[model samples]
Target: MNLRLSGRIRVSVFGVAILIAAACGGDRKTFAPPPEIFSEVDADAGTCADRCSLDGRSVIRCSGEIEPCPIELACGGGSCRQPCDAVATEGSTNGCEFYFQPPLLTTHNDWPYSCYATYLVNTSTVPVDVGIEFEGKALDLSKAIYRTLPGEAKLAPHVGAVMPGDGVILFVSDRESPIDNPRYVACPKGVVPAVLRDYYPDGTQLGSSFHLKTSAPVSAAAVYPFGGAASAIPSATLLLPVASWSKENILVNAWEAWRTYSPGVQIVASEDDTDVTIYPKADVHDGVGVVGTPAGVPATYRLQKGQFLQLVQPQELTGSAIISTKPTSTFAAHTCANVPANVSTCDILGAQIPAFERWGSEYVGVGYRPRTGDEHEPMPYRILAARDGTRLDYDPEVPRGAPLTLNAGEVAAFGAGVGEPFVVRSQDAEHPIYLAAYMTGSNGDYWGSGRSWQTKGDPEFVNVVPAEQYLTNASFYADPTYAETSLVIIRAKTDGEFKDVSLECLGGPVTAFRPIGTRGAYEYARVDLSVGSEPGVTSDGKTCYYGAHHLRSDGLFAATIWGWGRWTSYAYASGMSLRSLVSTPLLPK
Candidate 1:
């Protein structure tokens, strides 16, 4: 017998005449034989051909044949399927499980300071039950009280359940005491503070890592020195889930002045017996609690779950390479840092660094919007090289002093003015680089002598999410303590126009995005989230700053949340989709 197939089934017989008709059908379309018919034929065993259906939704499998499926489709489970079916979408900052290590913000026990993990519900209709776990025990939200600063006697309210489209801030830790004064806004109901053990002491080398798990996907942001006196240095960062953790990362941080304060790096282990090796970019001063290593030297340490190790140095640690045996969460921070080493005012700057694999080759950044005056100060940005011979090309040209070529473990710094958007790309994807944006202190006297201390915003450092890591939607929180809170949004022109994006608060549109950059493939917009002198809470007693925000577009976009007060400011990427850009064995050579 001979059979020929042409987009349909055909059978040829030798002598016997057989008539085959559709079982029950009005259309006369031919159909492929069922799998059972081929199973009985011993000669057809181990022979299969896979073809995608015309609609591309499924596949048709033929027995006793050796034809392969299309390149995009794979033969499996008796059908043709896309190989990506088994691969997950690129990881995002939002996830159901998260690990966080609160950076050392201040060493003063008398100063009022608190660490907060602000949870933003991503579900549209479903309420998520978020659990804060420390020391392997789930926290009791009912027993938790509002975090208060030092010298406060009255008991504040507890945090409430995080409803859909709403957000709740959990007091994760404090400096000296357990629960101190709660700042920003009034405590919501059904919310509780994490246990005291969650607190990572100031200037101490100890393990105080915590985990956050939720019934549904959610986005989290961490603010150190969340609520403190005016003198307190504040910093914030968008927290990445445990799924995005990797075995290697590079430290991107600001400079450390003489004896004032130190730039630090903290590593938190997700699994027990994780060995972390650090390659310092600058000389690490000893006697700062943790043993220090010299420039170009490597030191290794072993840590367990719920534990963290911190390295503080009087010199800059940017471009430092951290390689670990297991996945770990890493953060770049400054105990207290001045934008220019000579500047008087200082503030804490901290942000979680994505793994080296997630670093991208291209980035676009805009300086923070001016806090008060019309004159915009130049924002400082640093680019760290992931591989040797990495050359940078910037749009509209970078500053005169900016280094265009950088080797492995090298960093270049430049300043960009507000409203001036810049794009930087490395030689290629193989030379991935990390970008960090900084906000100068409020003193603003670096260039001139007449600068005043009454300036609004202070020094801050925020990691710039690569253009490749942009997400379509991001759920974030704007801190209420700052007098000015705004979002610096960058959307691809290839996506829909700016009108397609929406910033919602309390289930309604809240922002009128004003275009900032006019000439670029990417558009930049600044949305002022300020709601009068009082932040977070609206006049009608509704929450305004803590809620879900969505940018409706198929293309990717990036957002950075910034808030500033008198000599204090915080900035962080709203959310990022982490994509591995390099192969494994990410250890520096």
Candidate 2:
């Protein structure tokens, strides 16, 4: 198996991302472990308490936890356990609240599309109040504030509260409700959900989206609508706060099945006065970026703290890249596109593109549930060149449409047939490409594949995190509407020679599992998270990792959770490897 991230190549321009630690000058570099990890310090029992494994080869010897700690005997905390039903008000220590769009579960109008943001309270003793506040919204995870967006006009808050081991949801609807229209702000006091009456007596309306302020740390995610006026179908993904923000970006307009389906790139500015620039491909250039003068002629954009920009495009924007003076977060999507090419029906495609600073060179394309029907229904892949001349070598050699090289701002796509996973590598260490996977629209309908049934079985879009961002400890909450949820685990290297590389799914109902597919240079595991039905926990059996379940591995790897339900489908990577977490724990309780 090839352990190197880059393959041998003559490519010349930079590609999507390079999982770099901040370098001294402008020249970005590949990843190296922190110096403390390289030190020969033993797992000293003196500093360690509950012998916690770092999961898949990491170096943190556990003692204190930023996530919710259990009030069990081992940690030395006496049982002060009580129901967490307190309402959030002044003096609460819970973290600030944030709101992002989930499928609108609140409306029959939003039906066949059950979009809602699912959040989890990880603090065992912190029974914080949960509510929808529609003011100006700004979330700076660094400061732990999901404050109202300044100067925005009005809707009263809809409120509720939760204790440890509890999970709740807020439905998003754009149906001209109080939350969606400021005009209804003073309409009626009795319009509020009955369940929220005890929490906020003065509240009356539900916002299309909400800002949740908890007294403690929590986990939350948005189930991007599968198909929307803004996107194709309702889809799902995890939401990242400023703490998880990055400066570099991979911007690929999604693949288009219909000429009408336009792709989009959306970004959220984390800090105030952030300047962003786009280096868009004037035309298609496979595997290399435009030389010096062209690189400097990009379109520049600026954003205030908490503001976001969405750029929708056609196939022309595939290889575009975004660089910022400050850290920013981004999402790439299409209104809707067909999978498997020939299938007439289209589905939504989108994913949070991990910026260049958070990217890895090694990734294996794997997916959720089962894909059946025609062998022609292939997995469509988009590879965005971070730099020019990125030499791409693929396993199983893409059966069709693979490109030999890519220029910066250039994107190349090919189909990897269903169930067959493949690996991609770049020749140079600095030039890494972004890899994304798309499900097929029901293909093969004409040739005995029923045309009516040939509609894509709800196509999905997912991002594969690179091994450069792989980590040992990750945690998150699962979507509640989806009955089936599983994780596709990809380790950078194979270890059949040793005991199988296992990811210990400590919290929720997950089990310690082994990889089912080991091919080329990577080993892949399908972990049954069944998260919608269970809770998450960290490596320590007692700590409730809750919203974001803690994931540990014996080797470095990345995991993405895919949710499939009656009418929804979506996927997102775990948060352990996010560069922001390097300094802060995900849920600091």
Candidate 3:
């Protein structure tokens, strides 16, 4: 995260004292003529300086002689560049500033959820300007008020503009509304709401975080138990800007608690002291007590700018490990979870993670599809491991009890079903991992005699974006309360076949896709962005089902965005490419 270079080339002190007095050839007792004689006086004054051509992308100019350029080139107007230009610029989940913080979902008797933040304007021709603040108290002072209910009236941080492919939504935080209930879709016609002291419930203190500037790049998403409740159990992630925050992260999360509900990991700091640490691969309590950081011990914590730190337990913090010293914003939750723990309703699972230098050696799972007459089943996945040993391979096989070797904070898990798909990989990028994909419950019998599609949706968890963080274009969001919403995609081919990808929405395209797994080098598919009522969402304010989608592709791709219902479900991904595949700075010890 440090490339910036635009100018620098200086070399005078009378030309380095005449090249160190001509390398002392005339005496001063060979004045240090040993460092290879200053590398032969910098290779004869670097042939008039201005070099840089060992593949750092060309640049070696020097004709009239000016001297001083070549600490990897950058010589200003007279030529000698390569200071920055390798052409590959990719780091997305589009951006212009963002920093959400909303986990702790899934609730029924403790109610109080609703949070929002949908915006999408990855440009179609100008129209930008967005904004929203909220973040002001908590060094332990706690804040975030907004209770409204007596003739209600709060709304006030929507900023302005926002047109190209319009879709704004900001309602960050809730609690007042005949018992608050708005968890997925229905806030489209000019919705803004965000002012009861900038809402935020499900607590952990410090002004509950929320920022999101914008004047140009956009693509955010963070609905949380937001609207259309059947006892709301929603989820939706895809938010990752703050220039892709990262000081270190890893916590795949899901399955660790079912009855009293557990599995959590939230940390949001955005800067101001911010020191955070925390190892715990499991065994946490979070009734505060400063993380009670147990399982293997590590604990640290300091927070300040919109502070946050909530670490529930019930076991399963999947290979936990989050380091930080500024640049934080991680989330991997599950306050309900119940995929196979004897099924029977349970939901809420969050995502937002990416930073252990953007983990990924390769991946591509693909399950979740079956529902009409049910039966295909399987799903579940895990992976983890960010170092030590780490072998793994897998392709058209390897799901039955997975584990081809892992170590540093291990984790494996399996299952795949529903046209299968798989793909795994590791042993390369110095062994990177961290997959995660679960979603099963919903009357699970897998095949026995239950579930013919009655109330289909339950467990949830999603974090699979790897294939080297593929993304040619994406602008995701599809939640409309979820009676079922699809989109799995995958792509990647180009020279060996498959390419033309599209998707679009409300304004057209979206020709049903369909394919579903080609086995290895990627090619999945499975579209259908909405099912019941054939793709509903329309009523004056244009069209929507949690509107705003795009998805292009000329090559690299990757997506997810599921969404179930009844018992409830939700997934994430539809946006990635935050590059940086580790080279140091994982902060383990």
For TM-score, the strongest prediction is 1
Q: How well does candidate 3 match the true structure in TM-score terms?
A: 0.28
In model 3, the worst 10-residue window by lDDT is 12-21
- What local lDDT does model 1 show for residue 283? 61
Model 1 lDDT tens row, 1-589? 1111112222111111111222233221222111111111133446654543312224454643444556444333445543323111336776667777656644544334454545454432345666777878887666443432211212345355555556555666443344544332222333445654335545525455778777656678887765432444777888888878888877766555536577777778878878777776666555334565566667667777766776666666677777788988788887777776666577777788888999888788786667655444667777777776566666666553466667777766667766667777766677788888888777764344446547677778888988777666677766555667777878764423443445654343334444433344566767666633343424234344423355444445788888787677888888887768677344525
The estimated TM-scores of all candidates read 0.75, 0.61, 0.28
lDDT of 3 at 85: 22
Order of models, best TM-score first = 1, 2, 3
**What digit string (tens of lDDT, one per residue) describes model 2 on residues 1-589?**
1111112222223344322122232222333221122111234545553222232111223534323334321111111122222111111112234434332212222222322334343433455555444335332222111211111112223244454434444333222332432111111222222112101101111112234555544445555431222222556655544444566665666565367555555666756677766655433222111121133245555665545555543444555566678987676666666655556555566555655655545556765545344334456777776665455655655436666566555666676654566666565545566788765554433223444322324567777666555654454555443545666666544233322334434433334433323343455656655543443334555322113344544456667776554334566776434432122111112
Per-residue alpha-carbon lDDT of model 3 for 177-283, expressed as tens digits? 43443432333333435543224434322335777666656677786656533545666778887766777776666566777787776778877777776665545
Model 2 C-alpha lDDT versus the unseen true structure: 0.46
Q: What value does the lDDT take at residue 484 in candidate 2? A: 53
| Candidate 3: C-alpha lDDT | 0.59
Q: Is candidate 1 or candidate 2 better by TM-score?
A: 1
Error of 2 at 528 (Å): 5.1
Candidate 2: where are CA atoms >4 Å away? Answer: 1-166, 177-217, 226-232, 282-297, 373-377, 396-400, 443-456, 477-484, 491-521, 527-551, 565-568, 580-589
